[model samples]
Target: MENKRTEISDLGEFGLIDRISQNFTSVNNETELGIGDDAAVLNSLGSRIIVTSDMLLEGVHFDLSFTPLQHLGYKAVAVNVSDVAAMNAIPKQITVNLGLSNRFSVEAVDEFYKGVKAACDNYKVDLIGGDTTSSMSGLVISVTAIGMVGQDKITKRSGAKEKDVICVTGDLGAAFIGLQILEREKQVFMANPDMQPQLDKYDYIVQRQLKPEARMGVVHELAELDIVPSSMIDISDGLASELLHLSRQSGMGMKIYEDKLPIDKQTYDTAVELGIDPTTAALNGGEDYELLFTVSMDDMEKLKKHADIHFIGYVQSSDKGNIMATKGGNEVEVTAQGWSHFKKP
Candidate 1:
């Protein structure tokens, strides 16, 4: 039997909203009022509340040709949670707004919410409220994540001090390499419809691109260790770009050693195979979603033994400028060559 298809038009906007609301129940104590209200209510006991919103547009941020609806839904939530984690806050609630074209069905919407529910469970956040509207364009997802952190523990991009140690969580560049593989496979399939995508060997990098987890565990670990980073930012737009953000915001120069940069073996090998420099990919490739932070020398000692955190460099005076020391022992200026929404053609 063929799968049943339900038209979204059959159920009006209110009906669709009711269907979506039934699947998500509030679990967070802060979420006093979830869906079915004009606005979600939250109780922030004594902590500082942080809010972040991110939008993903089809044919821009993602491609439906290879992206699964479930994965896209999960990714949409994870990216916003990453922003919360960057602030050293615990994500508590989210409001997901969607714009769907006629091509999407009620079943398709259900499948997308399945992924959203999975992410809510994983991140321990409540799906409080959202809006759904018709769109002439493809799918558009906008997730607004709300989190809380102690007044003393919140980290920002402008808090770094001179001599602070710059640290990064997890390896970089795998996501970008994965995108390359995906685009290549897409082209191959376009050229010859009969040729199936050979993606078994590229599983790690491909998954890195498709489903990235927010580093909330690291935030908890830092609290347990009594370490608060002086500055922090998620590596969404590549290391070089994020580092520059920290440098400019904190008014400090950054000096990172290329040798200390973390690159997974698979990412490195794949870049080599594609005639791309691994270092270049690590520095300029975006969407890694890892945390890049700076801590005092004393706190650095505490995190030096962390298996996942790598010490990449240190902050310096503004006069020193932002530079990276090459493995060949030469220092060169670091530039932002990462993702830009609008660049001259």
Candidate 2:
């Protein structure tokens, strides 16, 4: 049977908002008001609130050729939550604004919202409120995540002290490798319409690019263990770039061991297959959504046995400079090569 197609014009703007509003229920008590009103209300959870907003452009931020609507929706919310998690805060609510072109149908919007709703449930955040408007070009998603953290629990990039241990949660470079695979598949399909994408071998990396989770688990674990990171930042623009940001902000230098960088087996093999260095991918690959943080040496023993956390380096005095100790025992100046929005492709 053919699926029914409903146009946005059929339901109109108010009707579409109503349809989307029904799919999400407020999960956070702080979300005193969600949807239906001109504004959403939130009960202050803490003395400090951390707010972060991220915008996703269809062509620049993501390629719809290989991205599913559901995955895109989930990714939109997850990426925003990642920023909040980086501050060592618990995300409470998110407001999603979408600009849709005529090409998007009512069912297409519903499919997108299903993924958003799934992400909200998984992250334990409430969909508060947002605006829906028409667009002349492509689908645009802007998400603002609101989170709360106590003054003492809040983490920043500038808190690192000399000799602080640099730790990273989860493996890196899978997302970049996933993008390579996706682009390769897209080109192959474009060249031949009959060819189907063979992606079983690349499933891990592909999924990493499609649907990434914020490191809220790691944050909760640190709290449970009564361990607070001296500094923290999410690994969105790759390890090397984020490290530079921390160094610059904290007025300190860093020394990271190349051999200590975590890379998944699949990511390593795929990078080699693609004629790219695995270390390069780990350093410069963007969109990992992992957390890179620093803990005082005194607290090292508490997290030393963590299975998911990898100690990659240590903070150094400003005179030492940002450097990476290679596997061959040579130190090289760390460079920032992460994603730059202004760079022309």
Candidate 3:
């Protein structure tokens, strides 16, 4: 059976907006008004609002060759929500803007929105509004997420104090390793059309690359435990990169033990199979979407039993510098060699 493909011109811009708006309804109390208006309105009540915007370009942020439109849409929202989670905030609303080329059909757009809708439901956020425009280039997605946090609960990268314990949620390096497997499979498929890519064994890492979840549960759990991080940043970049961010912003040094770094068995074994050090992957691999944070020694006991969180290190004076004590009993300065969109050739 042949699939139906409706052109975007069949609906026009406003018609397309109307079509997209029909599928989404605001579920957030803060969202006083949503789609079909000049601008969405929000009622923040007394909480401080945190806004974050992220843009995903076609070839730069993702490759559509093996990436599904649905997963891409879900990822677009997840990355932005991860930013909100890093601030210790509750995501309330999101506005997704898209630039679609004529090559994209209405059905294709629908598939993408299905993923977006799934994410909105999972995160308990409302899809308020967004813009759809024609594009000469491929698909472009820009997501802006709005979250709420009480003044006392808000966390920032610069709030870490000396002696505070460094912690990370979930694991690291899986996403980076996943990307490698994807690219490798893509190459194999390209070289031999008949070759089926062996991806069943790499399911976890592949999903980490394709559909990452924002660590909102951790944020909620922290609130329930009455523990607030002194400093926090989502591990969108590598762990080392985010650590450097905390060090530079907090005006403190970090000392993390290599053995303390968390790594999944699959991520570690796969890294070894690929001849890449799992520790290096955890250190410099980007897009983990995990939370890297710090808590004072006083609050550390509260999280001591948390299964997902790992105590990796502690904050120190700037003179001591950012160092990672190796399992071999050696110290080395941490460096940021993670993802860079604009790197000099």
Q: What is residue 125's positional error in candidate 2, in angstroms? A: 0.5
RMSD of each: 1.2, 1.2, 1.1
Q: In model 1, how large is the Cα lDDT of residue 37?
A: 78
**Ten contiguous residues with the weakest lDDT in model 1:** 1-10
lDDT of 2 by residue, 1-345 (tens): 029778899998789989999988997778899998889999886558889999999998999889999999999999999999999999999999999999888888998899999999999999999888889999999999999888999999999999999999999999999999999999999999899998999999999999998999999999998989999999999999999999999999999999999999999999999999999999999899999999998788899889999999999998999999999999999999987888985
For all candidates in order, the CA lDDT equals 0.94, 0.94, 0.94
Give the poorly placed runs of model 2, Cα more than 4 Å off: none
lDDT of 3 by residue, 1-345 (tens): 029899989988788888888888888899999987889999999999999999999998999998899999999999999999999999999999999998899989998998899999999889998999889999999999999999999999999999999999999999999999999999999999999999999999999999999999999999999999999999988999999999999999999999999999999999999999999999999999999999999889999999999999999999999999999999999999976888887
In model 3, which regions exceed 4 Å deviation? none
- For candidate 2, the 10 contiguous residues with the lowest summed lDDT are 1-10
- The residue-by-residue lDDT of candidate 1 on 1-345, one tens digit each, is 029778889999789999998888888888889998789999998889999999999988999999889889999999999999999999999999999999999988998998899999999999999999989989999999999999999999999999999999999999999999999999999999999999998899999999888999999999999999999999999999999999999999999999999999999999999999999999999889999999999999999789999999999998999999999999999999977777786
Q: Can you give the TM-score per candidate against the true fold?
A: 0.98, 0.98, 0.98
Candidate 3 lDDT at 278 equals 100
Model 1 C-alpha lDDT versus the unseen true structure? 0.94
